[model samples]
Target: MSNGTDMALISELVARERLFRARHNPEIRDCYYADATVATSWQQGPLSTFIGAESKEVDPRFVIVGSVSTPVVHLNGDKAYVELPTTTHMRMMVNGTLAELESYRRLIYRVERRDTKWKISRLTSINESDNLRPVIVGQDLHVIPQDFNGLRSSYQFLAYVRQAAGGQISQDLLGTDRPEEVERLYKETNAWLRAGV
Candidate 1:
């Protein structure tokens, strides 16, 4: 291929990768090469049911199936971290009706950049909830931290300190003698966290 053609292909692959990371519902089979294979050892299903199924047929249609939120994606040049919420649904073949099933799964997708395309060769999926910590305690602290912050001293301090570090906390963490550069410090800290440092 000519240099311009190769560049165009690379750009297309990058765009597809971005769209996939953004939770766009592209048919994987259509985008992936014919020889591509999604490992079945990590898949959840009857092992023999769809061994030869096309990638498009088996690929996800929805990023978040129910009340669950879409997972966050962190991407760099040739690597990405995708945290996705998997769904469980029961679809009746005879009636063609679908019902939400009582099941949940979490997945971390590791993407690799190949010569002309980006492929997901490794997927770690789990059905348990051990890793997830409650965003809020009994009283919706995530929604209203001020009302609950004062109830307990130690936890309040920790909470506010963390929030302030992220610039989400109130102004009292540093006291009346707070530094003038508090906000800038907090912003720097946030950037550091994003850099995975």
Candidate 2:
């Protein structure tokens, strides 16, 4: 990028790719390469197929997207690494009571420039925290704090919501609940980026 404007545009590409999902834009599928993969707290598989299935399963009326900060992009010729800080604000009914859940996480992406086109080769999510609160003051969401006893506190509320929505949590996902997992993920991603992948 030769100027601030150019850098800003380049940085926005990553965030825009994610926002597309919030908007239910079909073009989001175009942001990934043919073999691209996406791993999250509840799902891991080919990104395109995941998107297609998720679109069919997830309810559109409850879709929520808060905001995404400008992504930090590291360029290395044809390979790139990106980090996007994101907040997912969602509202759902918990046992007939209205509740809100906010999941704080970072989205990491491995991008590649092929044939003059930049596409995400791999995308992974690392969760830091989750908060759940009743929408009405002095009311309960019918969920007990102890219900999260065996769950990772870093993504407890998110996991609960996923389970409530019929989604399964994967133990293999990276999260702040396990520092070693975070370290290993970074180590492997950095190595992949440095190796000119």
Model 1, range 92-178, lDDT digits (tens) per residue?
Answer: 111122222233444444544567555554444433221112223332223344634452231243233334334343323321123
Return the lDDT, model 1, position 48: 24
lDDT of each: 0.37, 0.77
Deviation (Å) of 151 in candidate 1: 40
lDDT of 1: 0.37
Give the poorly placed runs of model 1, Cα more than 4 Å off: 1-27, 31-68, 92-100, 129-197
lDDT score of model 2? 0.77
Off by over 4 Å in 2: 1-10, 54-59, 165-167
Best by TM-score: 2
The deviation in Å at residue 96 for candidate 1 is 17
Candidate 2 root-mean-square deviation in Å: 2.4
Q: Candidate 2: which pairs clash?
A: none
lDDT of 2 by residue, 18-132 (tens): 7897787888888888799988765678875558764343345687776888788876667778889899887888767788888899989888778766778999999999899
As for candidate 1, its clashing pairs are 163-169
